[model samples]
Target: MSGTLALVPAAPGKRLGAAVLDWLAPVAILTVLLSFGFAGITSTRSAGLIIYDTSLLALLGSIGAGLALVYAFAVATVEGRSGNTIGNRLMGIRSADKDGYAPGLGAVFLRGIVTGAGILLAVLASVLVAVFKWFDAAPLILGPLLLLGTAWAAVVVVSSAWDRNGKLRGWHDRAAKTLVFDVVNGRNPVATGGIEGPYSFAPLDLPPVQHVASPVASRTPVVPGPVASETPVEPLPPAAHAVHLDTAAHPETAAHPDDAMDRTQVRAGVRQDAPEAVLRITLDDGRDFRLERTVLIGRNPAPAAGESQAQLLPVPDPGRTISKTHLHLLTDGTGLWVTDRHSTNGSAVTTPDGMRTALQPGVPAYVSPGTTVHFGDRTFNVGHA
Candidate 1:
C-alpha cells in the first residue's frame, strides 16, 4: 500500500529514434553496395545481358522501399507485440493491451500486414508514376509525391509516442486493443484502461508489467502440458530451486543425481503422502506464491520466533487443527517440507550444516526428509504415508 509512485510511460520518440537508426543503417549499406554495382556496370560492357540503365535506379529505389517495409512491419508488429523487438527492447520499451497484459498474436500479425502494405503501396505508387512519365512524356512529379507520402506515413507511425497516454498506435494496436509502454523496473501487475485515438488507455499507476520466465496458464491449450492460469503467479527463481527431498519409502534418499532423467526416475519411484495446505506469498520478484503440503508448527498458537509470522493463511479445512498459526507440509514422494506463510515469530529453517535461519513470513524454507523442523520448540520430523 505504501510505495514510491513512478509512471512507466511510453517513449514514442525513443522508439521512433530506434526505427530511424535501423532504417538508416541498411540504406547506408545498400548505397555502398549499389555504388560498387553501378561502377561495375559502367566499367564492364557485356552484350549477353541488358547493360545498366538509369532505370536501374528505379529498381534500387523499389528494393530499398521494400526492405524498409519488411524491416518495420516485422520488427514493429511481430516482435513488438510478442516480445519487444531489437529496437524497442534496446530502448527499454514494451507493448501490452490497454489492460496491461501481453498482446495477442493477432495484434502482431495485423500490425505487420498493415504496415507492410503501407510501405509497399507507397513504393508502388512511385514506380507507377515513373512509368507513366516515360509513356505520357509528362513532368516527373508523381515519384517525389509517392516518396514524400511514404515518409509521412513513417512519421505518423513514429509520432504515436507524442500521444498524451504514451501508447503506440497502428492498425493492430487499434484492432487488438493494445499499446506500448515503458517497463521501468519490470513490475507490471494488472492492466486497466480504454482505447481511444491511437493509443490504448493508460492505467492510473502504470507499473512495469513483469514477465514469467517459465510458462504459466494460458487460454490456448498447448499440445500436451499444463495450461497457464490467468492468475498472477511468477516462476520461482533458480536461486530458490527447492532442493528435492523425499519422505516416501525411506527416511534418507540420496541427493538427486546429475542426470535430470535419472533424478526424475528416482523421485518417481519413491516419496510418500504429504500434508495439504495452500499459502499465497507475494514475493519481491512480483510473483504470487501458491504453496501446498506445508505445516505450521507452534505451541501457543501465535506465530513463534524465526517461523513465518506474517499473513498466515487461514485454513478452512475442518479436519485439520484450526488456529492462527499453522504448519503446511508437502511430500513429493521424496521429502516433506514446510514454508512460512508470514508468521509473527517467523519460520525457522535448519540448514544442512546444522545452522538455523529465520524463514521470514514472506520467505519459504525447505525441510528435508526426516529432518527435525523446530518451530517454537515444537519439533516435527517429515513423515511418509
Candidate 2:
C-alpha cells in the first residue's frame, strides 16, 4: 500500500448522538402508546377525586412494553448483523470488535441491555405496577430509582467522552467487548483477507502456489540463483554467442566448461528470458508486475476454478483496505479489461485524458494503456512493459 489506512475513532459526540437515535424508535413507540392510553382515561369528579380506566391503561401499557422489547430486538439484530443501526448510520459510525468486524448478536444484544438498562427497567417497573393493583403505591419507591438509573445510563454512554483509549469505549462497549468505528472518514471492513494474516475465507477451488513466482516463471523456468550472481555475463539470448564470451572477466569460467555453460543458462533463465508484457503495472508501493494474460490482484489473491491460468498477485496491505480478491486484470495484446471483484472500497480508472470513472462490481471495464486503476488505498498504472 502507498499510504496508511488511518482509522479514526468515533467521537464522543457522535456516539452519544447515535445512542440517542438508536433508542429513539422504541421510545417514540412506547410514548405514543402510553400517551393515547392516558388520554382515553374517563373520570368522575363528584367525590372531590377522579377515577381512571385503570384496566385499559394497564392493557395499553403492557402492549407498549411488549412492542418495546420487539423493537429493541429488531434494532439489536440489525446492529449486530451489519454493524450499524439507523442511528449509527446517521452519525456515520459503526460498532466493531478489535479486529474491525461486526460484533455478533450476543455481544450487540448484551450491549443494548447494559446501555439501555435504565429505560428498560423503568418500563418494567411501570408494567409491574400496573399489572398488580396491590403495588399501586409502587411508584413512590420505583420512581426515584428509575429516574436515577436513566441519568446513570446517560452518564454511561457519555462516559466515552472521558475514555483514555480514544475509541470512545464506554461501559457498554467494554461489557460487549466492542469498539465503535468512524466509517465516513476511516477504513470500512466489509471483506476479510484471504491471502494471509488472520482472516477466514469461504472455500474457493484454488490452484497450487506455483503461480506466486515472478511473472516470467510461467513461460520460462526460473532457477533460484544465488544473490552472488552479480558476476557480469554477456546478454546473449542464444548459445551460439555464449561460448565466445570472456571466461576470465566472468566468474562462471573458473568452473568446468559444462559448469560455465550451465551457469550461463541459469543466468539467462533468471534475468533475460522475460516475455514482452502487454501491460506493465506499477503499484503504488513501487513494485512492478508484468501482465501477460490474466492476473488476480488483491491483498492476497488466488486463482479460483475457472481462473486456473491467472497469476496470483499478492499486495501487502496491513490495514485491509483492499479486499482478499479485489480486482481481476486481463490483458490482450493491445487491450486491457479490469473487473472489480465485489470489493468494499470499489475500484476506478483514470484515463490518460484525465477522465475518471468508477467501475461497478463484477463488471469488466475496458481501459487503455495509460489508464491508472485504483483499488482501495493502492493504485497501479497500466502501460507497456
Candidate 3:
C-alpha cells in the first residue's frame, strides 16, 4: 500500500536465473558433503557386516540436517546485510521492499524461512519416516508427505513467474513484501512521483506562428518607370554626405520589436541573462530536490563508524529498492540530462505530453521542461524555475 510499490520490478528472466544459481549453490555444497561421507562409509563397510552401524546412520542424518540449516542461514545472513546472495550478485539483482529500500533483518528472515519451507518440510518428513520405520505402515504415509513437500517447494519457485504485477515475486517475496530488481535499474520507488493517483493535465495548445508584411512595404507607393538602356552611373561628390537609415530610428522598418532587448549575457560558455533553468523534484511527501549541476541520487551507502555522511543526495528508501548510487543528473542553461549509473532498478522520463520512455544504462537523455524523471518510485519534475 505504500507509495514505494509503484517502483519498477525486475525482469522475470533475471529472477529465475538468480534463483537457479542460489538454489544450485547449496545443492552443490550438500553434494560434496554427501560424497565425502559416502566414501568414508564405503571404506568402513565390511563384507561380513550384514547391517550398517547406527552411528554411521546418525552421522549421515546429522550431515543432511546441518547442510540444510547452513544453506538457510547463509542465505538469510547475506540478504539481510546487503540484499544480495551469491546468485543475486551474479545476476546483477538485489531484493528490497516496495519502497525501494533494504528490507530489515526481520523481513529477510521471513523470506529465508518461506524460501526454505519446502526443504524443511521434506527433511521433517524424512525424519518422521526414519523414526517411525519400525512401524511398517509409516513409509506409506511419510513417503507421500515427503513428495508433497518437494512439490510444494517447486510450486513456490515456479509461482514466481505467475505474478500478476509482473514483479516476478515468489511466495517468499510476497510474504516479506520484497522485490528483486536489476542491479543497474533498481531505484527508490517511494520517492518517485505520481504514486498518489493518476495525474490530470489540461490540453496544451501553442499559438500558431504569424508572418506579417512590414507596414512600410504595405504603405509604399508603386510607380511605373520607363525602361532605359543599361548605362554607367557616376559616383557621388565627396561633399555630398551619404544618409544611412537605422532601423531603430524608423520603427516602421523594424522586424521584431523585442529582438533588441532579447540579448542574453554569456558567461563561461553559459547564458546568464535569464533565470538559470533547473529541475525541481518534489516528492509526494512534499520534500523537494533541486538539480543544478551533477548530482548522484540514491540511498546513502552504509557509513563507517564515526564517519561523516556521504556528499551524495540520499533519498529515504526503506525498501532497499534504490541502489547506493542510482543515477546522475546533469543540467546546463539549455536543459537537463539524466544518466543511469548502472543502478539496479533503472530510471525513466515522463514528458509533459504524457509520453513515458525508459532510459538506457550509461546513456544520457535530455529531459524537456515539465517532464518527470523517475528513479524507481521516486520522481522529480524538470522545468524552468
Which model scores highest in TM-score?
2
lDDT of 1 by residue, 196-283 (tens): 1101222334455464432222334434334455555556556545433233445466445443433221222346766653233332
Please, what are the lDDT tens digits per residue for candidate 2 over residues 107-142? Answer: 988887787788777766766665654244654856
What is the clash tally of candidate 2?
Answer: 0
Residue lDDT tens for model 3, 96-131: 665445565788888767766766765565556445
TM-score, cand. 3 vs. native: 0.42
Candidate 3 runs further than 4 Å off = 1-7, 28-52, 134-148, 185-385
Q: What overall lDDT goes with each candidate model?
A: 0.46, 0.72, 0.61
Listed in order, each prediction's TM-score against the native is 0.37, 0.51, 0.42
Residue 372 of model 2 has an lDDT of 92
Backbone atom clashes (below 3 Å) for every candidate: 49, 0, 31
What's the distance in Å from true for residue 124, model 3?
0.7
A best-first ranking of the candidates according to their TM-score comes to 2, 3, 1
lDDT at 54 for candidate 2? 70
